[model samples]
Target chain A: MTLPAHGLPAGTLRRVRIVGTGLLGASIGMALTRQGIDVELSDSSPTAQALARDLGAGRLAEDGDDAAAPELVVVAVPPDVTARVIADQLHAYPTATVTDIASVKGRILDQVRALVEPRTLDRYIGSHPMAGRERSGAIAARADLFAGRPWVICTDEDTPAKDLQHVVDLARLVGGTPVHLDADRHDAAVARISHAPQVMSSLMAARLKDAPMDAVALAGQGLRDVTRIAASDPALWAQILDANAVEVRNVLTELREDLDTVIGALDGRVDALGVLASAIGAGNEGQARIPGKHGTAPTVYSTVTVLVGDKPGELGRLFTEMGEAGINLEDLQLEHANGQQFGLAEVSVLPAARGPLIEELRARGWTVPE
Target chain B: MTLPAHGLPAGTLRRVRIVGTGLLGASIGMALTRQGIDVELSDSSPTAQALARDLGAGRLAEDGDDAAAPELVVVAVPPDVTARVIADQLHAYPTATVTDIASVKGRILDQVRALVEPRTLDRYIGSHPMAGRERSGAIAARADLFAGRPWVICTDEDTPAKDLQHVVDLARLVGGTPVHLDADRHDAAVARISHAPQVMSSLMAARLKDAPMDAVALAGQGLRDVTRIAASDPALWAQILDANAVEVRNVLTELREDLDTVIGALDGRVDALGVLASAIGAGNEGQARIPGKHGTAPTVYSTVTVLVGDKPGELGRLFTEMGEAGINLEDLQLEHANGQQFGLAEVSVLPAARGPLIEELRARGWTVPE
Candidate 1:
């Protein structure tokens, strides 16, 4: 697929260098290479460089001793190191479109503006691919990593349209949807949706540390399900959280008030019920707004359970039947039978499909548990 | 598949009846059925009875109008009506073992005890399955719902050992792990793991209602992922929260204090950093205690994203490969690529297997992003 109006024409683009061999950088190079775009790769660490090369991400550039430049250089580095790298890149490569993939845009944009040349700054547009994994490093990168995920390009009037489009083209090449927003708005929005959830999940997970083993053992899918995000890389998150501290701090302040209101209501304070209820209600409201599998929020009919063996392919058979019958499963759970031959598989389908699916499974030699 | 002998083989048990056909009761019947035991099913609602029958959960006993004199009877009703039903059951079948499947045990137990005969009271044990879903009602019931889930049996010395064994048998039959705790302790524990999570999730999800549509549109997997539990039955949750008011109140108080401390830290309190750090650290400690798959916390390695078309079987192929490779995925997210050629499939798996899995996929001609 040709790059949208945002990508450089075939002959005009000679080199696209990615400066870090971490997950994001590796992923970007992989995607660009998949599109047959010739790209150069570089990293301070030789191990990272070797891994990137071995992974077919890109070949390391030769002119990387003190100062090296490529046609389009993307700085996919940690937030703390983003500004320094950008400034150094500006001095190193006088003619190249430079952009950095940083989680927090406002601080990075501000820092770069203060530390780098204005004309040099005009060539940069901040972008963040709203995608990630629990693991890090170039080894975890995939070529189609950004496909269909939002790639927020934070730009201002000073960001030349050509430069912005170039970044947008890069986003498109990786199969991402481009979302344009001001740096401050992007930071605030991410704080609410992205960063806040991580902190919340981590904090919630942390609460279990001192709980009795029994209580911890009794932890259901809900706790595991919610705090799953907490299993994220702590070091990487520390940088992201610290970079967006002001916005994250603001959001936490609001959440704190809401928590107090909820606690007050539970304590029998007047209207705290209303406050808490509204907060919960707000959460419900927000939850409902999220689109379900069909890219729309369908009314979840509810969930049902069926007993299946703990052995392999039990889930495969269950899901295969559901799919073959054209049933949409909204949510599912496998209640591990710690000491039994079978586990309970809770399946959530739309209200209408439950009966037929149950019936079909029963007919298929699967024990539908009377 | 026979019930494990706890005490006296539950003493020539004749029959155990479940008076509701919702998730808990149906699961009870299913578990018992698996153990070659049959449950007499009754529900005030005909639809529930029929649904239970259709699912082969239990046979509809002819003594429908009158409560049967069974060795044990479980009253699985909505929380608000649970106590009243238990009292009614005691009056109708004084010799039977009685228990109610309400999330909040203490309040219902207390109320039922005050209202039942002294002799009948001693035969009862209050239980709350630390398992449920965002959906409810009999249509959503599955016989295996409680497998490996916690069945909190609240009792005192006044509760006969025979009756307790019967209750434990019931728990075991349903493939649940039995935990014997008094009403208060059980309630408090539930508050920490189950109820508190629901409350928190609902409160957080509520905030998204008024978020800018664009911001809402940009809602990533994190928000959708965390708030998924908030889309629960509000009316039912209201009753549950109200029934366990004391325990719920106490937990919320603690959470409020923690929230305040977090907020205070964010607001620039001199000691805020330490407090915030402690809270987060507590979350870490708590998270680590949670057992992973196979009752041991497996190390979570990496999340790898695969971009695929939003057609049928894309996920199936992905999962099949992961399963075939003997790699157990811990979590998954399917980000629909805003009407693109492929969706971003992010799978969380053990870190050590990431390289092998990616390499395997690449060998299969699938575009393994760098």
Candidate 2:
């Protein structure tokens, strides 16, 4: 996981202290450590700090180890405790600038300001890296977790330019793209994209819990895709939703109206076809709003479905052959049939490459279904 | 696509008539035709019928053709037209055993029963092949589309064993496993797993349609997975949802209640964490109800994440090496850092194989991050 050094000095910061040793904190520590920056880690749970240390995130911090404070401190605690932790970190290292990576920013910023003195508030900022896996803890931490991810920094009137620069530099050091935003806007955006989706996905999957086994067995890739996020960390998500509940509720209310309209059409009170088509069309437009190079979906790309054994390395080989063919993949989706031997790899490529890619793969002893 | 066939007796019975030339109809025609059975295609749109015919789905039905009757008539039309088409097919081919592949079974069965004579009703059966793509029309048809998917048969009291066997034989010919259930059960099952999911996905995506670009850009894999099904055929889904509105509404109402609970927790009115945790836990349980090779999930399978380029053949190489390692992949997921040069292949294998697989992959010059 080592890479050539960058962000050699965290801008006048001789050392960095991370107050939490969870995935986000440990990952920040590792990323900074990789750049030869000195990092100290501590967690309320001794085992956790020890584990993060064992994972090479950083060394443990001790009282009076260095009366001269580190240049910066990062508080990566749970959302509910973020403000308190941020205030503590600001107080613990009086000279050090501090930032907390909390998904919900508005409340945390307000709470931290109320808890800390005006002087300490100037040295603190709130930021959130739009990154995480479904798993939790230091065990899930990686140096490259935040690479290429968006890290939103919330600015306050009391925040100093020096502290903001340090935070931005840290984000860059971790290979994150930093975006400047206010706390309210950041919270609102995340509520729309993150918290609401979690609730929706969970609500859908919840229906399946009480369903018959046969009905559940009737599930397909569509159901799998729609319910995948329903598997997120319950403890963490609960905290996040509570933090951003108001904005999330606004989104949820609108969704309810759409649901009610579709239900009415389905109930045969209106022209079902028109109502249903408009609902699905709205979804289509919404999905398209997700900007990417995915190209024109459900079209524009020719799908080359290669059947590989569900055993290990088959996908690797298939993709390797695709590389040899010199075809760019617009997207790749893998679908498995429970009782079937083959896993279906639906690779979407440019329509122009369809003939050549399929021909090349088939010639390379792969099964390319037309 | 040719098969040395056992459904040859189906060919001997006269012909197989597909009354719609869309994906399902064309696919059924192709599967039957490939099994060396005679197939006749007809659709309301001449262009659609012609396209299906050109795609080798089947030959077009002539004016004087099937005077005696085809052995089987599949009414693969929209849910609204299903009953009428089934009745028309039954009357047109009095001696033929008729089936409709509409998603909903109860209403269609009731409608057809009320429209047709007792004997004609006896000759018809309601069936739904639990398969579809996000796309529609003849262009998306495939002979193996139904392979490894469940085909549900809605049985009636008057359904003769011989007619049922004919339908079962058709299912087998298309590589489907047939499950027999009454119309009510079939409707309820599809409502829970299929129709309700569509409504939920669409409802979520509908929110995104008016979202700010930056907010949408904050979208991640979870959002994508949850909204992927929202891109389905709205016209078709509207009809399907309308046909099964009652059951869909029941599920939606319960979901609304769960939403309210979570909203309350978010509003700081209740023990937010407890309510949120329970809601998420319910989702976890419901997702678990999905019968699959995925056991406990996020735990059962040891994940060996292999870093590979987002290019054509990198994935193929990873899978090939996986096969060479002699490890069976329990499940595989591919995640790419948006705008990154490479994607990560997360291969889940048996816990025992994890250590060896990682060592082997690393030895072969692939990065297997823990």
lDDT of each: 0.73, 0.81
After the best TM-score superposition of candidate 2, give how far the Cα of residue A116 lies from its true spot, in angstroms.
Answer: 1.2
Judge the docking of candidate 2 as incorrect, acceptable, medium or high: medium
Q: Which candidate wins on lDDT?
A: 2
TM-score of chain B in each prediction: 0.85, 0.93
C-alpha displacement of B323 in model 1, angstroms? 6.6
Off by over 4 Å in 1: A1-13, A64-69, A271-279, A293-307, A318-335, A338-341, A344-360, A367-370, B1-12, B29-68, B116-119, B268-281, B296-310, B314-338, B341-370
lDDT of 2 by residue, B1-370 (tens): 3443564653233368899999999999888888877889999999999999999899998897645467788999878888998988898887889999999888887898899888778989888898888878898887878877778998877789878877888888887878888888888888888888888888888888887777787777778788888878877887788788788888888888887787777777889789988999899888766766432122366787777777666766777777887888777676656656766677788899989988888899986654
Compose the digit string of candidate 1's lDDT tens values, residues A1-370. Answer: 4362344444334468888889999988888876767678889899998898888788887764435346578999878899889887877777778889999998898899899878888887788888777668998777766776789998887877767767887888877878899889888888888777777777677666666666676677777777767767666766676678788888777777777666666666655435554655677777888655443233455555676665544555666666777776555555555445566667777788778887887888776643
lDDT per residue as tens, model 2, A1-370:
3342465653555578898999999999888888777899989999999999988899998777766567789999998998988888888778788999988998888898799878778898889998888888998888878776778998867678788888888888887778888888888888878889999999899988878777777777888888888878888888888788789878888887777787677667888788888988888888877655332122355787777776556676777777877887777777765566665778888889989988888888886644
DockQ of 1: 0.40
Q: What TM-score goes with each of the models? A: 0.86, 0.94
